[model samples]
Target: MAETDFDLGVVTAPSGVLVLGMASWIDHWSQLGQPLSERASAVASIGGGHVQDWMCELVAVPAADDKALMVRAGTTTSPFDGGPTIAVLEIDLGLPWAGTAGNEPIILGDLPVDRCGMVLGDAVALDSWTGDSHPSTDGLADVTYWGGYAEAAHLQYGGELIPQHGSHVRGWLDLPPDDAEKIVDALKAWEGDQQGRGVMVAVDEHTDFHRFNRASWTHPLRIGAIEVAGCPVLGINWDNGDHSMRHRGERRFGQVYPVTLQPSPEGQTMMRWTIPPHAPVCDGPD
Candidate 1:
């Protein structure tokens, strides 16, 4: 395809550029004799008990000097709700593209940035391919902590407890007697007279806390027990973070948990977790 025919824009990262177009573009490129190879594939739960399969492929786009790596991703099962199926391609900045006479190769500073891109495992891997900073494993660690917290809630409250919010939810997880004792000690050592000191106890890479606190600006956490499809679960009663002008924060929850350290039918490394039956109704946190 000619440079003018390409619908492309740079993303937030200087080295990261995106090829925005329909999903059919992948087939069209392949028909044009471009080399395509499967990069990575996986099934992940987005939210609300829904799951989707994701696949990423590496496309070799010919350039004047060398080949540019264009990573494309799309869902195999279906597109995300209310979102169209789109292809995202990340190009290698080091490679030179065929340009008009006397025109320089596209640089990050030369083009407008487009932040819209499908988030896929291979897209993340593109950062590594381009020698950019790799995505952090902190998100996986946080999910483990949340699984432990949800399990603790179930044990203590005597019902099928679901995570009402994301990582921001603060509460003690019910742990074994020995582990619980250790958590208590940790809490004692970490707790202070400070109004909102965040205290956490990681028991064998899982969360087992003795006390949880909310920041002064946020609303207090309230516990409410409810039923979902005849199964009882713990619920949250609080504001949706829109009461104050300063409360502009995004909330995300991990709807899956890892069954084991290895891959399995349950999930590759993450297992499914319960979600609230309906969006939490709430009053402003006071």
Candidate 2:
């Protein structure tokens, strides 16, 4: 049986960038190729829970004990100076409903488990991955399943389905407990403050289909829960979906990051990622 450990931390970055976030010495997605998709084809069609041709690896580990079970991760050209700590759990989900022996099952024993990617086991504690949207909206308007999926995962308590997204929803749990709690509190506060607002969902800003950096267009980064940082200082990145960039690119999903919340910002509450360094930073947020 797989040893369950919901008491792990999460550190999410922009999609495609996640592989870069982990400090893996050998950053290959599969034994067949460097890029994950090269070897694993036939992505699951949208709306289908099943994925095919998937495999994963353990890149790196923070603690010696965790080394035995973690999938190492590394970054190539990140903005950060040194390659930071990243716990990777990569899986090559095969084609939708392949109905094969190894393609259908989601397993945790294949790779890393301790430092990062622990939220894959905890539902209630892991912050739901919400793409950028209005503060009033609970889940990403475009990603309608985020809230429902979160509720389902939390309710299920720990199952194969909880952590299946290739790179859609990433959670960060690498900060002190207090800091993590701040994110949780901020998210709860945001949800409670605006439970029934008519917020726009996944409204694309660029029409040219040529521009990049949709985040530059300015949309809402909704808040259902706060994701605290564990590496260093607390920050939150502001963003929304960009069709021009995502229509046919790696960013087809949305993105998230650490940023400085403005003082008394409009629409969304300006939250500060405040937490001291003395507390545990890898457990579930709050």
Candidate 3:
């Protein structure tokens, strides 16, 4: 096919930064001991749901480095059943189109699954520091853990911490085979609109509907769409163990649902991060 038009709409911003920003909001709520519901009322006043853009330069070893990967993500949180659920953090990286165009986005360092068990505030605190302050590797690890547990809990109970002391119950989303096909087609359209860019969505699952205490990856599907709901069982950067694994048959027979979109206030908007002036890793061969 002729050069595909990879136009995902100006690539407004990276979803990692946007998701972190949203996570920070939850962090703020968690610190306040609020109910922590993922309802529209919680984020509706914010710019609908802020679509974030993030970019970073990765150095080879320590001091200065070259560009590794470029990424963009988006998400929104709302209350479901008796708790909260987030339909957020859609990721796109490693697209041949973006690389050839000289537009690479860095995936946020992975957050470990173990570390995700910590309070949201702790995770944000760890992520606040830049490479100048802490080893980039460590920071990535922290988030990987955070992403894992956060996703695990969300998919299991539609909330962050499984109701404080109560057991956790996550639901797996198994879209109909036809619906799955439709989602893939939607993503293809999105890629075409996004300058031939590809997209991935990861959702978490609960280990048991009755047990409500453990969780696992039900099914992590790669679909073609602007956005998908539920939690991310598996993270974009899985090498770090920042993600969870889904069950074998969940994708084939679980129930699927639509994610509700919240309204954003006029003045509200998502956050965006530009490449720092002094990137240690840029213009280098990967």
* TM per prediction: 0.19, 0.17, 0.19
Native-to-model Cα distance after best TM-score fit, residue 80 in candidate 3, in Å: 34
Each model's lDDT: 0.23, 0.22, 0.23
Q: Which tens-of-lDDT digit does each residue in 2-91 have in candidate 1?
A: 111122221221212222111212223233442121111111111001111222222111111222332212211111221211211233
Clashes of 2: 34
* TM-score ranking, best first: 1, 3, 2
lDDT for model 3 comes to 0.23
Per-residue lDDT of model 3, residues 175-275, tens digit only: 34444444444433443223454333322221111111122122121111111122121222111111122111211333111122111223211222221
User: Which candidate number maximizes TM-score?
Assistant: 1
The number of clashing residue pairs in each candidate reads: 1, 34, 57
Ranking by lDDT: 1, 3, 2
